[model samples]
Target: MSLALPLQRTEVLVIGAGPAGSAAARQLARAGFDVLLVDQQPQGRDKICGDGLIPDAHKALARLGLLEQVMALAQPVSHVGCIAPRGGRIDVPGELAVLPRRELDNLLCQAAQDAGARFLAPARFEKPLVNEQGRVCGAQVRIGDDVHEIACDWLLLATGAVPKALIAAEMCERHTPSGVALRGYVHAPSMVGRIKAMEVVWNKAVRPGYGWIFPAPNDCFNIGVGVTDSHKAVSGKGSKKELNLRAIFDAFCANYEPAAALMREGKLLGELKGAPLRCTLDGARWSRPGLLVTGEAAGSTYSFTGEGIGKAMETGMLAADAIIQGKAKQWNDAQLREAYEQSLRALKPKFDLYQRANRVNAAPWLADLLIWRAKRSPRLLARMSGVLRETSNPGNLVSLKGFSRLFLE
Candidate 1:
């Protein structure tokens, strides 16, 4: 594709209107750059997520200057209810809230537009346009039946999880998804006030996976299950990993009483939906000449909690910062890529710890151990809360040292 007589030109083209893309676009546009934010779907599209915003998310929202606004629209909660196999339960205190993606994403996208970024809807990225020098100069975007070449100095791919967009950009390193998740909203008025915390449930029946019930605004409960291969599934050594997400979801609804109670008392708002997750910060090449990958396209989700909203926004801001700094400092593309990748390197250890924490999902008994210890030891419970705050390491709660600390410390 050629950029000759291109009708659209932007200094930065951010694909996808999710938290990451919107956040990046907002910052770039606020900095007085020509930014164009596009997404295949129209505004307010429902994204598959647990809808729980923990402390880490709070901090990110605060930095975006949207914490107060989001909290006003969110279901503010003080704790996360963690349930173990055999039904042991504990509420870990932290800064937490629930807001549906349908609302949260649109709020961020609108914020980007308000910040002077041009926004386009129903725009799909077909493929990148590479210059003669092998640098990405633009992309071909499909809108309805017509396709247009959009020229840009930099492209940030924030298209989450689905690999087709990544493949088109040659950014997809692995075709296999890091994990899969299922979720649905149920309108349970009776349970709305009753279920206070964002509840996470672990059990053997959903090995390599877990379940959650987050109370949202308007008496809606977000309930779901997920299976991830951050480390290994309960599947034996060298075994092919296959998953039936629906079956696992069904198993979760059956074995977990909270999910069952919610479903029985409330009607499902829509069908249970599933989406793939790219995790471990290992799904794609971080950067190339004139282009950078962020968000779930860069594998931003955590394997342990399937939490990515905050990290997605963080990486988006990081990407915007890289471009801004590169322009101001007159740095080369290599420097731009290095700065972004190094920033991610600082975050990769946390992603690793989250992946290590996935072992508890595989071995549900570990949850029982932690809950058992946490109930007796306020110190242990505080550490778990610190994990939500990103002040403590998640791996410590699941490691051998973690296990020893249950008895010793």
Candidate 2:
């Protein structure tokens, strides 16, 4: 028997209680808005991810005043060791943090609830509720066979890259192919090997996509590979047998000397899982009437590195800021759309530059040369690391002037 509850109404309805949704709801609730945050899974569910938070992510956490919380639960990563095709490598100094996604997501969601947002878990989103004029007014959700209509003055979609949510909300016709990645964890203490830096490997084996061995808390490591769908078109590598990310990951783990030696003793923690990555935000409609889309669903993931956590949270904050401020000014849908679009436009520089860098790195030779040059110059290496931290501009890293200074100067 379903329990009859009062009609669910909120000033803001946030779908998908991941980092993005939780962050947005937290901010809105802090501003005294009645926000409803919902997710498909219960609290603290494991989310497949690299779990590495680069400097940019740290900045976002700091903005939310949760840096201390993350610091307490995270493994410190102080440098990045990037390997290029043909054995070119560089070690750049920086600060990064890693923790299990299960912990991180739950912490963020709990923070939201503490700030006054209402959270509903194990509630699956069915579709966006649209009014007669096609404006999103709320969401249709199901909680254990009892359907609920969550009416809201504003709706925000933070559903990550899930295609079902996108299609249900009419955000995208079909999921546009962007990037694919496979990752798994290994809990081998013997494999720790005093390696404190995050390792990125690029070789012929995983051309166009890169492999990473990131240290996790408790002496484990997260290993993964990411490949953009446009790799073949840009690299001019003619279509051949389709590359299986899992098979490639296995071959790399079995053949790559470092990874092979480590995995020989390390046990895989779980089945290797793969997911699609969204690389661009240009095609998505950010705001329509009363609805706003953020996170990976809006293609906020970085193109080169396939890191979306930081960008996802940033977009979430942007959406919340727009709504909070718009409500103050009593702005209509047109004004709200303008504010949200402009906020996204402000982020275009980084995304555009990252795309260019992605294309530049598609060529193994150029990547090799860049890494080789950085290895020889400490100052250049620091600059390269700054890009990962978002302190330096990515456009400069891929610019001819920057290359000359790092290589010829």
TM-scores of the candidates are 0.96, 0.93
lDDT, residue 140, candidate 1: 91
Which 10 residues in a row give candidate 1 its minimum summed lDDT?
Answer: 231-240
| Candidate of highest lDDT | 1
Q: Per-residue lDDT for 18 in model 1?
A: 98
Candidate 2's residue-wise lDDT over 1-409, tens digit each?
Answer: 1223336888998998877898899999999999988888988877767888988788888888899999899989888888877777787777788888889999999999999998887888899899999888988888888788888999898887766787778776335546778888888798776556788887777776788888898878888888765323323222323668887787667646677765777888978888777666744568788899898888888888888888888889999999988989988888988998898998988888888778644665767877878878777777787798786777677677877787664
- CA displacement after TM-score superposition, residue 119 of candidate 2 (Å): 1.0
TM-score of structure candidate 1: 0.96
Could you tell me how far off, in angstroms, the CA of residue 50 lies in candidate 2 after the best superposition?
A: 1.2
> Candidate 1: deviation at residue 43, Å?
1.2
Error of 1 at 303 (Å): 0.6
lDDT tens digits by residue: candidate 1, 262-356: 98999999799988888889868899999999999999999889999999999999999999999999999999999999999999999999989
Regions of candidate 2 where Cα sits further than 4 Å from its true position: 1-6, 230-241, 399-402
lDDT over C-alpha atoms for residue 68 of model 2: 96
lDDT of 1: 0.89
TM-score of 2: 0.93
**Cα lDDT listed for each candidate:** 0.89, 0.80
